[model samples]
Target: MVFGKVIVSLVSLLLLVGVVFGVVAAVRSRGGSDNKNDSVSSSMKSVTAICQPTEFRDACIKSLGPIAKNASATPKDYMLAAIQTTTEELKKSLEVAAKHNVNRETDPINHDGLEGCKELLKYAVEDLESAISMVSGSQVKDINDRVRELLNWLTAVYAYQSQCLDGLDKPEYKTPIQDGMVNATQLTSNALTLISGFADIFKSLNISVPDLKDLKPSTSRKLLEVNEMGHDNYPIWFPAADRKLLAAQSAGRVRPNAVVAKDGSGQYKTIAAALAAYPKNHKGRFIIYVKVGIYDEYITVTKNQVDVFIYGDGAGKTIITGQKNFAIMKIGTMQTATFAAVGKGFIAKSMTFRNTAGPEGHQAVALRIQSDMSAIFDCSIEGYQDTLYYQTYRQFYRNCVISGTVDFIFGSGTALIQNSLIIVRRPGKDQKFTAITADGKEKSNGINGVVLQNCKIVADRELFPVRFQIETYLGRPWKPLATTVVMQSELADFIRPEGYLQWDKVNRHENTCTYQEFANRGPGARTNRRVRWKNFKVLSPQEAQKYTAGRFLDGHLWLKYTGAPFTLGL
Candidate 1:
């Protein structure tokens, strides 16, 4: 029996090596192209077929040409080469950004932005590395098998490679930095475009996507499950955090790994100190119980700190506040987050994250969560503009309050907010309108959007009476293919009958965007007077479940264990 198993393993290993060697032959064959034999041209031509579909064909071919050896026709090999090439190119950009960080011209003003670019590029490197791992693995066959998730990560790479320049104060100052980052940007774009147009690439190679329709969510859910793990060993109070977390703590049911209090009563006074002591390679959730206090500091939960659960006294009492603003501080919008979560499986409850930048602050963010499978419950996110930046990956929020003036609850990620309150604050002196969300899902195939489910939208006391004077819109397309769905929610009367405003009145992205409201109630929910955009629709019950927590985010696979109130489907 052992001999037979060993034989099987050896056979599989040989087959895997055979597939990779074929591509390796192409890299080796490039040097021999000058020989002009039919074999050499065919070898090079076969590789060129892969690059033909990319926008930067020459760059695409050249990117793979340098490191590649010999030849193989497997699409995965070419993709691996492309991803690796992108990763290498991004490292160059990171070096350039680091040099710019200390440059005298960038000394005071552009230094922070340059530093931000370095950080964003580092994130891009991680995304590229993950891409390389995804395709290089033995389990993945065609990129098409995991294309949905691949697009999400690759799309993020494209976004991050350039967002650093977007935050620079001077338009002309960006040209040099943008030029330096263009190669990685173009390569990232090629990888994303290649995956997006994989079917076309396959057709060019005279083949069809294997078992395309047979692909199931269960299989993809399993893939998501691999990157993250959680235990259902939460105290009884966790499931109903707002109602029972405090009581459970008092009852000695909740056991936390660490305690942070402002009065120095606990083991740590600062949340940062608690996070600094995060155990390496620790299994299961590391719970941190924060006592009631108004802790004023900028908090960043870095990527290495995974599965850290922090529950505070309450949103009203235990507040994490910052006064960072873009216009005032010159820190980029991406850097202005009062609280940022870049880790995986981060959970925060009963806390208020507030940015006091006000409307004039222009893009100040209260909470920016890029954590995969992160959940925020019973919290309040307050800011004047750009309050909640759900940057990427799948996220869940429930029973929270989010208030802002412009593009507040916005992000380019797959997220669901259930039973939450959205307060529209009065705009700054220069601002004439208030937009609630700016959905940044750029690709049509990308699994990203902000879905507000069973929520309430209301105007704050200062803005309620004057709400009619200021055009309050549900959302505007932040990207060409942006998407947002407000399902089974209550939209107060102040929201305009037109529902949504155009991102650009002249260009009007509504024709290309997806803005939907399904079974939403209240006076503003009536869609009779709504803008008849090309993709806007009132979805039927039959089509609603696809956007629900169970299907949209595959929440059932993970949410069940979070002890949060969530419906698997409509």
Candidate 2:
């Protein structure tokens, strides 16, 4: 019985050994011919090929080739690696820039410039890190938006690096910083190119992409219209049955609800008193005729007083002036306005809103409009700094003159300023830069923007010497998503070659800011030397049409009511 059991055990051991050998041979065969392994290898090769067409092909290969060698590396992985390399280069340049010490009081220009570059570079790094995180998340579902946003952030990185070089204008300190910035700029540009190429590759490989469409408001909000009839359509907002009553008041055919005069000839001696006497929520339009005089009172047309029309004899003859300023009043920027209009459908014609706090007062605002569908015609807004705040909502300004020292025409409103003169005044002794039109749109989907058409950009050389006009810029972004376009405008020689100024020492508005000029004439209108910001464009004639007064402000439907003349299209 013992011999029989040993024989059975030997047979069992042989069978186990045979089974192990068979399993090892099968695993080796599968490793050589697995479909998943072959697909991964092919993908890596494809990713490596993507780097060949970029300008910095050698840098791309050196930075991304090792990652591609890994069989599991995806297109996203390769992109992440390229971004990582560029970010590292930016960090190194920032380190070099930070070593240079500058005194704000002694070397203000260079000091501010260097400090600005450091802040920009740091923001660039944070933006790249966010981009990397986006790529690692589920991107396939919204790949188009993801790719576009990624490209914007990457383009901003390249632009910031260039700006860093431009800010270090001193030759002695520039060379060292330039070398590092150049490398970072090239690397980031290559990364942008590679990522841009991915869209085409995905299309070729039959990947799904979302349809690109204009996500902004297709139509503007239409206010109540007035036909020839004396009947009202929206009685809640306009209680009166006669729409012509408001039109007659606007045309001086009917008596004004209130008259403002410096002398005791009128019921109200001050404009503020006239505004206070004006009916609130009475509907229709309350007309106030401001007589020819300089009324030195700060006025506000409150929100409850909708459809208010205030007009004067002429721009210079009837002036509303104040001296409220940042330095003197110690108030917020918005509160410093000499005249503020916060009512819907507010209209002003043939008047001057002036802030007497000269350039040294910093952000003294002359006129601030926070109303929707408002119009200002044949008027003058004059101040030293931060004049004419077109704060929020849709507005129109025509046949007017806006003059200031810095950011003379600014705000976050969707404004179409046409047939107007934008005057850049001389800066104060401590001020170095003068910028006009600081649009502050804060979102991609926002309908807020500024479109300047048939306008003249001139310097007040009469107030400032020719030498003081050396640092004037057309505009600057006050927010990351700020957008402004100048079409068919006449620019003066005082405008800087860089065209637009940086917002301040540190802000990431450069990347997301949209600035363009089309059909602009004069020495400063030359586009060859404008700052090569990624989103700044010299729009084609076809592209410029969308920004015309008719299209941009939807003026065709509403402008006639304001009695303001406007060119329908470009």
Q: Could you say which candidate leads in lDDT?
A: 1
Q: In model 1, state the lDDT of residue 227.
A: 33
Q: Cα miss at 42, model 2 (Å)?
A: 38
Give the Cα lDDT of each candidate: 0.75, 0.71
What's the TM for model 1? 0.81
C-alpha positional error of residue 537 in candidate 1 after TM-score superposition, expressed in Å: 2.7
Please write out the lDDT profile of model 2 over residues 1-570, one tens digit for every residue: 000010111122223323333444455456674555555443334444666668877787778767768765544566578888888888898898888877766665566567757866875786688777766664333332244345545645654565565456677667877876776777787876665554344455464333212222212221232222234332222445225675564566767789988888888898888888866458567889999999888888886787888999999999999988866555546667899987778999999999999988988999998776789999999998999888766689999999998887887667889899988888788888888888876544334678888999887766446744458888899878779998889987777888887798798578889999899998778999998888999999877877766556555445666656677678
Give candidate 2 misplaced runs (Cα > 4 Å): 1-242, 246-252, 467-469
lDDT of 1 by residue, 61-143 (tens): 78767434554445456567778888998898887776654443444346667777788889889988887776676454222
Poorly placed runs, candidate 1 (over 4 Å): 1-53, 64-69, 72-75, 102-109, 137-147, 197-222, 225-252, 504-508
- Assess the local accuracy of residue 475 in candidate 2 as a C-alpha lDDT between 0 and 100: 88
Model 2: how far residue 409 lies from native, Å: 1.3
